[model samples]
Target chain A: MSINLNRFNRVNRKKIFNRIERTHKTAIPQAPKRPPLLHPQLDISALTDIFLSKFSASSSTYQSIDCISLVPQLVLQYTELHNTNKTLVTNLQSLLTLDKSPLDWPDALTLSTPPATGEQALGLSYATTAIAETGSLVLCASKQNPTTVNFLTDHHIIILREQDIVPNIESMWKQLSLSAEHMPRAVNIITGPSRTADIEQTIQLGAHGPRSLHLLLLAGD
Target chain B: MVEHYKSNPQGSASNSTSGPHQTLFFKAQSSHALLDNTLQEALKKAKGGFIEKRSKAIADVENFESYKQQAQLVKNHTLDHLAYYLTQFEDNLIKNGGQVHWASTPEQLNNIILHICERRDAKSVIKGKSMISEEANLNAALEAAGIDVTETDLGEYIIQLAKEPPSHIIVPAIHKTRQQVEALFRNAHDLGDRELDTIAALVDEARLQLRQKFLNADIGITGANMLIADTGSAMLVTNEGNGDLTATLPKAHIVTASIEKVVPDLESASAILRVLARSATGQPITSYTSLLSGPRGIEDLDGPEEFHVILLDNQRSQMLGTPFEEMLKCIKCGACLNHCPIYSAVGGHAYGWVYPGPMGSVLTPLMTGLKQSSDLPNASTFCGRCEEVCPMGIPLPELLRQLRNKEHEEHLTPRKTRISLQSFMWTIQHPKIFYWLTQITRKVLTNTTLSQFFAKYIFTSWYNSKELPKNNSKGTFMEQYKKSSKQKKT
Candidate 1:
């Protein structure tokens, strides 16, 4: 059984708009004034510094990489540190075609592509933009970079391009508008690993998402 | 309605009921809550953390007040043109292969969700924390229809197991203690003498259990914090990531939001977001703030196949042009609840129904009739902290006063109160009698025997917990002022 949209408009919408028109007769609504930017004038290095500190404060860790090719090595190293035999699933084709392909990688590390079935313990993605104010990584979902690889993993490593770091959330919106579509189907602004302060207000990480979020800031971008 | 569901496994411990006029028993309920040691302990432990964290977060920002003003303006402008933006949101969402359903009442909303679940033959459903669902009594309806509904948020999961309504909005089970949670988990789960001591162990156990629920569920339901009108996307903010998992892993994703949640664009939504988390949980940003527009794109690897957004009006339309319209600006941050002395003392369950604290005082009377919840508006001390800390700039105290006025006008005020107020008004209007009465009262207070008699009998309630100040030997303030003026003239 479906709700009759026509009736809904006739009953609810009509009454609502009528009331609005009657009540707001003297005060016509207009465009609101935009607030001044919280961080209007910040250089790239300063933005990166703020981003790294704030991200680390959110229970996430990061490493500044001068080159993007070292991401796979860091992922392999992370797996070894954790001593887990989980596969590292990633959608970044650039990682595979970099200085060394997965074929030449160490036998201890296992690599797989996206469309992860909730079994991959490690997943990596490239953030479209990073916000310095809140230390958020904006990931726009696409065919190449599926959304599942972001959440269905124990360890999530994001590749943040140094040039892609925006000063604040508002500036990040402007950057997203410059893209081809109005907005991607899904844009996740993930900050820190999944956590909850629900049980007696004590915070615990790994609450149905990645336990640890490691950021690889690629300065070479 | 859903009577049995409200008073759940915990039974009389939680006095929250799901229908109208439940707030009529606010006096007895609040008294009981005051005596409930477990609830008082939980409230005490959960109280200072939110207030301190929020203040610290607000201080860290440069010109946080300017952000609050911008957010208030954004909400005002959107509410003024709500019809326009709502239709735009619907059109854009439909363009993106998503369907929009409207419900004018809670029953209609439940019916729409039930029909969708029934059509999909959904046997198992995983749900994120949604206040709208609580308002609609969706869980009871789904359970009655034989669907297994599991709440994935840790706090919501605990409350669901205990079968209790949320005491706090952002931290639903704020009234539950760690020991109480251990008991609930022991009763619900088949734990064979496994230790559940630390909060971390409880969280890990819940994660292990809910992870399975998230994968096998056919439908996932979530609440949208903001609906972007320009982009046709529903933005959900959660620290636990349960909302994202629920929205992504299922075959069909259902988002339930009130119509007032729509904003003009992503920029407007961001304007509110800057203040939303700071006011709610004091986080700069939640762990996962996902903007899920439609279902997965054609070539996408993983996402839901169907996306549906249900918008409920449910008396919100009537609030559009009323004195309470400013209340629609609320983002459900629970700041007012945390700072409220009344709420901090008696906790949320005493306020009855879904909402609590200063905002709930104004809302309960308005949403549920003013007569049934007349006591809610009178329950406040007019502390004004709620409005001061509110990110949306809602005048909560003034709204509660308005509700009180409405109650008085409707003759819902108790007879004794009305009579006493009328007598006070009459005496104040007659200055001669008022002066004489004040002089006589001053004389009586100066006499120790008479003062003791008045304290023991007349003002017994006032002297219960506090002592009266020593009476000044000098006369009333008027007499002192007159004497001072005469001396100045001389």
Candidate 2:
């Protein structure tokens, strides 16, 4: 049965490729003829500032915390401000990975579960990489970092190390390609919270995903 | 030939073997749409927003044209070697524990989906914006089979409730005003006696309703903006992130995509991505651009257990070698639709299909055959705005002209147009004779007003809608030339 299937595949492949031969110009992939974007020389700190401004312009908010201890304080500040009950936390306490978790984090945060639907008001997640050009957070799903925490909540908060910022999407893609074999289940390049302009071309935030995205940028040595 | 391809760009489930022959009424539909007060009001609100946002986004970018060139190059190269990249994508998907299915016809595609859903006994399915699914009429197929299907996108959900196919490629409910949406919500949602007049309330109501449906859905299906061959990733970009919930929350995820959506690598995908959202919604990037490769691995906390991708060729394989090949490069950004004056005037429903406007004009005829939707190709004024704003640099007007030529060759156009065009062609071939003949005609026209009896007969219905310009007393060009020569002699 397997041999028959393989033979079927071979013939099918032959026919498809033959169709391609009649239609296409057989050209190998080439380097881009010209650069699409000009990357101005901005040091890490300067790029961080640009990323912050771009984020705000895109309707996302951010704050630079002096230390890791400040994240819990920021969380309390947001929780009190928004009047949310439970906070969904993903990958914040994974021991297998070398990435550290918040040391004195409280029990207010929980893991993502099905159809808390609108019940889960606030979500806190750790960013894999922060893209500087578009002000996007690169979130990778793992055993600890359930991807649901990024989407299911009404308000989402992300923690990022300042050093992990990449200038462009291409730069990040190139880096990710190096570790191709160990790719996670999903990788989301998220810019702002959920939004839609589908109705009469009117823009609305938090259509189905989070209403607002808040970033807690941590300084790295 | 007339029966070969028919129906709207959004496929009808009834068009299994024999396609829907409904798109032939573009004339009657557009006429009615022109006078529709509600649609005109809706069009007004939706108007200028897309154009303004797009211009602002383009102004922000330094070298937008160069990016378009790069995108065109990427698409052209991938299309040339589509079979290779498709197989590579298939192999990678299989390796990542995802399944790939092939479908050549809409019937076959629908059957494959039904088989998968039946095997799992899927009760309900959540959907993202899959134009390919729309092309196959998947929702009709699923609903007919006793499966509850919900569209998660805010626009799609609104249109789905109203029992209307998407008028625009990107914004399905672009034809609907907020008041109409409020009425749709009041009628559809079980939460009755609720005041839902505002857009925010409508969004909140949908969010609450779809939020429950997403969690309980047995299967999730979505469209791909671009499928990455190297990584076996089906990337989707959306502002709402409903696609993310649909894919991650469901037990089984099915991707319904056209075969031409594939690109060579992530770099090429990024090259196109830079221009896609910038042109589509004028965002640097959407809220979410996800690369969901396969089913959940053991390391992942929450995602689908089974990942299936259905690559539907339909008539795209035949389109590959034809002049219509450029139509395959469309990313379905709706830029052409947004920029078109005819579309802005009549709205999406007037086109009478899942796809509308300039892109739909070329695609509807190509996909649904020249005879059934012969009016669509002629519907355009050849304004060239669609081509000017197109991110893929598709020659929309030239392609429309090719479709017109096909219509002329097939004798599908009206006898009057054929005779007029034939005469025009013959006259153009003989310039001196044309000039002499035009000199006599111009003398008559110069002596007469547009309201003349002969003018009424010549212009016919065209005169009824539009008044011609006043007569020119300067006589014909040949007479002027003769007078100039006489003056030179003096």
Per-residue lDDT of candidate 2, residues B1-490 (tens digit): 2222222334543255432345789888888887899998888988999889988998876778887888888898777778778877887888788888776566666777788888888999999988888887888888888999999999999989998888888888988999999888878878757878788888999999999999899999998898888888889998899999988998999998888999877888888888899999988888999998889987676899999988777667767767778899999888999999999988887776667899988887777666778898988999899999999999999989888877877789989888998899999899998998887777666666534765588768677656666767586767788999999999
lDDT for residue A9 in candidate 2, whole number 0-100: 38
TM-score of chain A of each: 0.82, 0.77
Residue B345 of model 1, lDDT score: 94
Q: Which residue pairs overlap in candidate 1's backbone? A: none
Locate the minimum summed-lDDT window of 10 residues in model 1 chain B. B1-10
Q: Evaluate residue A12 in candidate 1 and report its C-alpha lDDT on the 0 to 100 scale.
A: 57
lDDT of predicted model 1: 0.82
Clashing pairs in 2: A143-B299, B5-B368
- What tens-digit string does per-residue lDDT give for candidate 1 at A1-221? 56655575457555545544555554444444433333334456688788888889899988888866577678889888777665878767555423245323456667788776678889988888999989899998887578888888888989888889898888898898822134577899999999999987888999888989999888854
lDDT (Cα, tens digit) per residue for candidate 1, span B148-167: 99999999999899887888
User: Candidate 2 versus the native: TM-score?
Assistant: 0.90
- The alpha-carbon lDDT assigned to residue B24 of candidate 1 equals 88
Model 2 - which docking category? acceptable
